[model samples]
Structures are given as structure tokens and as C-alpha cells.
Target: MESTEPQRYRFTGHERVFHNVSAIEALPEVMALFGYQRAFVVCSRSIRRKTTWIDRLHARLGDLIVGITDEVGEHSPLSNVLIAAKQARDARADVIVSVGGGSVMDMCKAMQLCISENAYDRESLLKLQFVVSGDGTEMLTTSQAPAAIRQIAIPTTLATSEWTPVSTPIDDETRLKARFVVPDGSPEAILYDPALLQQTPVRLLWATGIRGLDHAINTACSSSPHPFASLLAEKAVALYIRHLPNLGDTTATDSFTQCQLATWYTGMGQMSVPHGFSHWMVHIIGPYGDIAHSDAACVLMLAQAKWLEGWVTPQHDRLLAAIGQSDTPFHAILHDLLAGLGMPTTLDDLGLTRAQVEAMIKPALEHPLVTRNNVRPIKTAADLRAVLDLAWRA
Candidate 1:
């Protein structure tokens, strides 16, 4: 049943999504839209050394491409963010063009904050975090400054970090994420090229699509449902279920395009919806086990879906209808879908031990995200442990 609650859906820095088009083709017009020319490109090191994509981009942007850095690291380490922030600042870059996955885009967004606030060091950067009170109210000071330096993302993976203004740059000192909700910090425009996605290794590619699928499913199962959010997630679920199974087909560019489109619709809606245990648990278990975020989602989504078998029946019905299949239970359907995609489905499959799974229990219980937004109440270590047991072998 839908809750009788009013909700506000906020749009951030997102302006345009140029799909089925390469970055070299779409960037100039996007730059003209903002009347900006100077671009500081950020990408993965592999793309820089291995691919011609960067050289091509440099050729296209010409003098407008002032500087480029590929040192953001996998998790967007805060130290790396500080380093890259200075590079973009010194270059006097008007925009940051992220040409990689979530970490690179996250690095660019944090760089925008560091440059704008002129806060460089860890202590100063840490101050940017919002404080939460005992009553669970958050206190934050906003500059309300219009975004001076926004980002333009060309994602190589299906994790749709480009759609969000919030960036989580991990602090090396604490080994945890520092969240920043910057005004206009999101990509001002996103370029989605299925051809670019094809360059990603197949397992990695399918895993990220599963991550996008995670957003759709968990948002659909959000305790406080927004009708529009649920509606978009419905479509997203269908698309993901349809196209993600075709991961092995390298020639299937249109299917890959469909996967990319599915991510956008899911990301747009899930921005407003509070997610469930599967989503929040990914943060802890993924990093703990050194698994990629999307890979972690592949395993945990199945685990949590199985765990929630009885509790979320109504929402499961909604998802079933969306996929036009009312026969199989949602978890089983998801398990078969993931199996068909050759994705991971258990903690064992991810190479995580029982000890590691046991270790994450305290953190999951302690995490404010789980406490505040997880679909079901997780009040104790036992509560988390119960669900985790199902994950041992899926």
C-alpha cells in the first residue's frame, strides 16, 4: 500500500542526456549551451594509456581541454581528490569532463567543492560534511552559490553517478566515505555512448548494469513510496530485466543502449526514494571484501530479496506486473535473471568468508543510512545477522 505522505522531488545539476552519441560529437554543443570552453578531463588510467579516446577528445576540445588527470583511484580517495582539485583550479577550468566510471565522476564533483570552497586539506574538507543531531535532524550551511564549475560526464560503466549531485569521496584516513551534496555538483550534461560501454570488460559491464538494476528494485521496495518514483522504477525494472541478460552479446549495441537508458530512468526516480538493506549493505560488504560496488550488488540484491520474501509481497507484486510476469516470486525471478547474466549471487560467490560477513553486522546495524532508510527496521546485530545467513550460499 502507498503511504499517505507528501514528497518533494528535487532536480540537481542535470540538464541534458545525449544518448547513442559519442562524447566527441555532443560535447561542443553542450559547451556552447553553457558558453564555456575550458575543460579539465578526468578519466581512468587504463583509458588514458590504452585507448585513443583521450587523444580523440583532446583533438575535439583543442585548447578548451586545458588539463587532464586519471589519478582519482577506484574509490575517489580524498587525497587524490585534493590533488586533482588543485590541478583543475590551476588550469582555470570552466568545466570538468569525467570520462570514466563512478569514482572518476565522484572525484570531479568533490574537486568542484574543493575549488569553490577553497578548502584544500583533509581537515578543511571534512568541515564540508553536514552535521546530524541526536533527533536525526541534519544541519548544513549552503553557499547557495550558483555552480561555477559543473561536470560533464561520459560514463564507461552503467553505474549512473553522473545523474546525482551527491558525491562520496572516500577518506583515506578513516577508510570511509565523505558525502558532499553540492549545488550543481552533478554533471550538467551526460553523454551515453553504447560503443564506449562495449569497451568495458564484460563481467564489469554486466555488474554495473546489475548495480543500476539494484537502484530500481530497492527504490521500488522503498518503505515510503513516491508514485512517480515507483512508476519510473517499474519501467526501469522491465528494461533492466530485458536487456541485462544480453551482456555476452558484444554486437548488441542497441541492447546496451537500452541498458543505459534503463539506468537513467531508474536513477532519476531512485534519487527521491529511500533504498533498502541490499543497497546500504553494498557499501559495507563491497569495500570490506574488495569487491566492486556493482559486483557486490549482484550478490547482495539476491540475498536481500530472498530475505524479504514474505515482508515485501505487495511491492513484489508491483515489480512482477512491471515485468509482465506474475508467476515466479520476485527473488527467484531475480536469481534466474542474474544467473542468466553470469553474475554473482552469494557471499561465497563473491569470495567473502563467514568471518567477513559476521564482521559487517555491527557496521550495518550502526550505519545511519540503514537505520534511517532501510525498507525494514534493523534494530540489532541479530537482525542483520539473520539476513546475512541467507547470503552465505544465496
Candidate 2:
């Protein structure tokens, strides 16, 4: 969108972001500032076991770190969040220090929801999901009462979940994802340290970097794009293209640090930009297919680029220019990137059955963001199927 276009972007409750700083060292001053004493530490299992970060955290905060849970799963199952919430409550934690990637960060957010809403029972929180109408209309039926707790984050991956307040924990009982937005729930501060990145596996790092790349691409092509957001999104694309494919081989700290900065740029204007196409499709497909989000990005973005090859020229051209890949068609460029990263390039590659793909269609079509803001208007089953077909290996 033109800068002249009227727009508004409210930065979430997250107050400050510190880069290349020790998250543990920054914790004491941030905690004292907010009068946060008793702390609940929710971390990924890898961080707790593979590395000494958790041990370091325990040593740094001492008695102030009231509780810790490392039972966090890959997708952040709702049962996991519920159980962790009970633990945090029993320990009387006043703030949550979330240390992990997207799922861990969002798990912390849902824990806050469970504690604040007093809806510890899996059934209670499951019912809190907003209803979506057949025509893609949605009602915001979440509790009016403010969310009980807030978060401070130390990120271990480049998914950029710490930068947003929204959390989606999968409901294990139904195999669906639940969305929650808590009052004062955004991170109070986010500390980004490349040393933390070392704990994340190279494949995981590559995957989440692709997720960050997904964010940047969709933001740039958003239906209601903002000039400032597009600028950052474009910059993120260049950085990701330059650094991502080589991350695993080089394993250099400079490459990791630059990817972190690219991740931040990807989601910095999330509030201002409304993304479409692959972004919304991933939300539905990732949960339903049990595919990791970044994996979904691998399939969907490549397919969507193919589906949009000639349809959205100017936006595609700008993104092509940003990545210095104007000579190649966008989808081919994406295909080569996936090849370079040794990532999957289709839905069939993830073992998703045709039945699962069909089952996802109705909900994907009804999703509010897909309906309202998809780059191209989706008016028929054929329109949605076109992209899905491109994404499937067979």
C-alpha cells in the first residue's frame, strides 16, 4: 500500500527487544522493573536436556525461579499446556519466562489463558474457540475478562513467536489448534542471543528460518500491504536468501545472527500487515496434517508461487527483485531453495493422505483470514484446489 494510504499498527505489549545480549543476565533487571518475583519457567525439552541453558537459568534466578516444566511437545498439545498451567498455579508464579521456539512461546501464552480464565479443564479452553460461519464470518467469543498472566521470552529459534501475542496450541483430543489472545499477554521483553541458537538443531534452524522466510514473503504480498512493512519484509527476504541455505554447512555465528535479525524483520510489522494465501493455508494444513509449520511452508509457498506465477505480477516482480532472482520464475527459485536446504517440496512428501487434504478444504475455505484477505479472492472450490494440487507430489 502507498504510504499515503491511511493505516494503523499497534505494537503489542512487548516493551523492549535486546539483541546479542545474554537473556539470563537481562532477566534480573527486567524482573525487578516489573516487580515480578516468583517466576514460572516453561521451556522446550531440548533446551532442558540437550543444553545447560535451563541449568544456567536456575542458577541465575535461584529461588525466584519458582517452577520449571520441560514436557513441552513439538506442536504444543493443549493437554500439555493445561498440565503446565496447573504446575505454574501450584507454584504461584507471577510471570512466565518462555524459552524455546514457537510452540514453547505459545504454550506459555496458553498457560496464562488457563490460569486467568480459570479454565484448566481441557473442555473449557477448547470451547473458547471463536465460531466461524459458512461464509467465513467469525465471532470473537473469547472471554472479556483480561488474561491472568503475561510473558517474558528468550528465543531459541527464528520463528519470531516472541514478537507476537497470539498463541495457537493444538487440541489433542480433536487434533485441531486453538487460538488465544490474552490481555497484557505479550512478552514484556525479548532477549535474542545467538548463543541460544546453538542449542537448536541445524535442521530445526533451517526449518524455522524457512518459517521466517514464509512470514516475509506473505507480508510483502499481503492484500492490504503497508509500505513500511513491505520494506522490512523485502529486506528480510534478501537476508534469508543470502544466509539460510548455507546455515547448516557453514554453522557460523555470523550467519545465525543475521538470520535472527532477518527473523525479527519478517514479523516486526505483523500488526500492520495482513497476510494471505500460503500463510493461512499453513495454519490449517500444519495442524491437520500434523506437519511442522516450516515444513508446510516448504510445500505451500512453492505451490502458491506456482499458482500465482503470472497472476500477481507487480508484487511478484518486487519480491523477485528483492531476492535478486528476477531471471527465474518465482516457484522455480523457491524449488531450488528447498533443494539447497534439503527440504520437502510437496504435501505427499509429508505422508498426508488424500482424505486429510479433502477434510481440510471446508475449514480452509472458511478461515477468516483466508476469506477476507487472501491476495486473490477465493470464490470456488476450484480456486482453493488449484494451489493444493500444485503442492501435492502426485
| Candidate 1 structure, TM-score to reference | 0.94
Error (Å) of candidate 2 at residue 108 is 0.8
Task: Give me the displacement of residue 72 in model 1, in angstroms.
Answer: 2.0
Q: TM-score for every candidate vs. truth?
A: 0.94, 0.92
lDDT score, candidate 2: 0.80
Query: Candidate 2, 321: how far from true, in Å?
Result: 2.3
Candidate 1 lDDT tens digits, 220-264 = 888767788888888999998988777679888788899889888
Error of 1 at 10 (Å): 2.1
Q: Which residue ranges in model 2 land beyond 4 Å of their true spot?
A: 1-5, 130-141, 249-251
Q: Deviation in angstroms for 296 in model 2?
A: 1.1
Score residue 113 of candidate 1 by CA lDDT. Answer: 85
